[model samples]
Target: MTRHEQQSRLSNVARVDSFSRDTREFVEASMRGDGCLVRVTHASVGSTDIMARRGDYLLHPFPGFVSGYDFIGIVEFIDRPAQSLGLSVGDRVAGVLPGMGAHATRLRVPSSLLVPVPDGLASEDAATLPLDGVTARHALDLLKPSPRALFINGVSGAVGLLAAQLAALDGVRVSGTASPASAALAMQYGAATFDYGDTQWPRQLLDQVGKVDGVIDHTGSRTLNSVVKRNGRIVRTAFGGPVGHQKAATAAGFAKTLVQRFAQPSEVVCSTPMYVAMKRRSYRRDLTKVLELADSGRLKPLDPVVYDVSHYREALDAAGQPASGKKVVLTFGE
Candidate 1:
C-alpha cells in the first residue's frame, strides 16, 4: 500500500489505551524497553491535560494521569546498540508520545520518535512544538484545504498559529482570531487578524472576509455565520471548548466536517460520528521543516511561560489559567 494509505490504516488501528489508575505506573518511571533515557529540561502543559486535571473531560477520570506530552531535553542514557538516528548522549531533542509521562523530570523513549533541536532554538520554545506542530499538520491534512482561502478560529492559540503559518507558506490566504495582545503576532505569521475578544466576531468575520473555503475551528460550537463557502470543509480541534462539537458543526453549517480519532484495532471511539483519524506517514520531515523555519526566523518564536518542575503545582495551575496564552512550560533544572 502507498504511504498515505498505510498512515490511514494505522490511524484506525493505533489505539490509545484509556487511562486507569494502573497507568499511573508510567509516572515516576526511569526507563522503558531499550529506549533512550532523556533528562527533560522543559515540558509543555496542553489543554487536554488541563481538562483532565480539573475533572472537566467527560471521558477522563478525576485527577487523571500525569499531565504532559511534548518535551524538550537532553539524552542522559541510551540502551545498548546505543540508539542510532544520530542521537548522542548530549544531544538536545524534542518529542511527543501518544499519552502521559512527559511531565516528569525524565523518561525513556525511542530515538525514532524524537527530532533533534536545532542549534539556536530555546528548549522551552522547542518544547511547545511536538504536540502543536504535529497536530496542526495532522488537522490540515485531514481538512485538505484548497489553495484559495482558510480561516482559523482561536488563532492566538499555539496550534492555530502554527497551522496559519504552515498553510500560509503553501499560498493559502489565512485569517485568524486573536486578541489585541496577540494580533500583531498572528499577522506576522500571515493571518488577516480578527479580534475574537469582540462579542460579535462571527458577524465581524462575515463583514470582512465574506467567505472562506475551509476553516480550522477551535471555537467549540460558536458558528461562523455566513462566512464559509457553500460546501466549505471544517476541522474541529478543540474538544473542551465552550460548546459541544455536534452543535458546533450544526451551527456552522459545514458541508464536510472532519471527524478523526486515534483508536485501536477493534476499538471504535465513536460510531455515530462515522469518522476516524490517521497518523502521519512520517513526522521527522515535518519536525525538520518546523525546526528549519524556526532557526531561520521564518516562524516566530514562542516565549514560554516557564516553571521549575519542583514547582509543578503552579505550572499546572498556570496552564489551566487563560492569562498565559498557549505557551506554558515546565523546566527541569540542573
Candidate 2:
C-alpha cells in the first residue's frame, strides 16, 4: 500500500498507550520536520527495570512509565520534513521506545530511526523479536555451547523460551524450569522440564539431568544453586535490587552479572553486521524453526493475556501477575 493509503487506513483505528512513547516522540519530533505519521505494529510487556532509580534518571525516563519498543508502522501523509528521507509503504520496520500512545491510532516517528523487518514474519511476531530474541541470542553466544548441559530458570518467558530452543540447536542439553503448565510448554520446545515448586525438584533434576555446565537464571533466586556444577557459569537476567545483587553474588560468585544491555533496534539494527545478516537470513531460519516446532505441536507462542489499548494500566497489571505464561499485550482488535 502507498504511505498515504496506509495513513488513511490507520486513521480509522483507536489510539492507545504503548511503552515506547518517548522514543517514538523523539523520532516523531525529528520527523515532523519532514511530515510523517508513525503507527505501532505490535508491542509486548515483559519484565523491565524501568522502576529502579538510576543516576539522575528515572527508570522510565519517558512520559508516564511507558517503557517498551516494537515494530512500528510509518506512513507519509503530506510533503513535509520526513519526506526527504525516502521512506515508503510496506517497508518492514522496528524500533525501541516507550509504550503508550504510540500503540494507539497514530504515531509520528523519525524516518532515520526505523529498520526494515525481515521478510515473511508477521508484524506482531516481528515486534517481539528485536529485543527478546536479540538478548537471548547474545546471551547464548557468550556461552558458545558445544554439547554442554544448560539450564534455563524461567523457560516460559519470551526470551527464556526462545533461548532454550536456540541452545538445543547448538547441541546443548537444554533443561528448563517453570511451574507445571510452563514446564509442559518448555518440553514441547525440546527441553527437559522440571517443576519449580517440587520440594525435591532441584535434587530430582540434578539426579535425572546431572549437573549443568551453564545456567540462565531468570528467577534470580538461590533455589537452583544445588543443581549447578562446581565452577559452572551462570547468566542472570533478574538483576534489579540490592537483594538481587547479593543473591547473584552468593550463587554465581563474582561472575553473576547482568547480560550487557543491547542497544535499541533503532541503533543496533543497522549497525551490527551479524544482526543485519540475521535480519536478512538467520531470523527467518530461526523463526521458521520456531514455527515448525509450533506446527508440529512441539512449540507454541506463550498465550498472551490480551487487553484493550484503553486499559493499558490493566495490561500492565496483568503483566505483573504471577503467571506461568507470557506477557499481557494491549490490542486494538479482539
- Winner by TM-score: 1
Candidate 1 C-alpha lDDT tens digits along 224-303:
52566666656666533352333333333332222312211000111111121123225666666787787887876566
Model 2 lDDT per residue over 1-334, tens place: 7986654544322222243322222121212233345555456655452231121122334333324544345453423433454446655455543332344445555554445554554555444455565556655755544438888877877778878877876778898777886778777778888777777878888789888876776544556556766656566654334532433333343233322123110001111223433353444334334444444544344565666666665665666563754555655441
Q: Give all TM-scores, in the order shown.
A: 0.74, 0.61
What is the RMSD of candidate 2?
8.5
Evaluated against the true structure, the overall lDDT of model 1 is 0.63
- lDDT of candidate 2 vs native? 0.52
After aligning candidate 2 to the native by TM-score, how far in Å is the CA of 50 from where it should be?
8.4
- Which stretch of 10 consecutive residues in model 2 shows the poorest summed lDDT? 263-272
Q: Model 1 off-target regions past 4 Å?
A: 1-31, 62-64, 79-84, 197-200, 241-281, 323-326
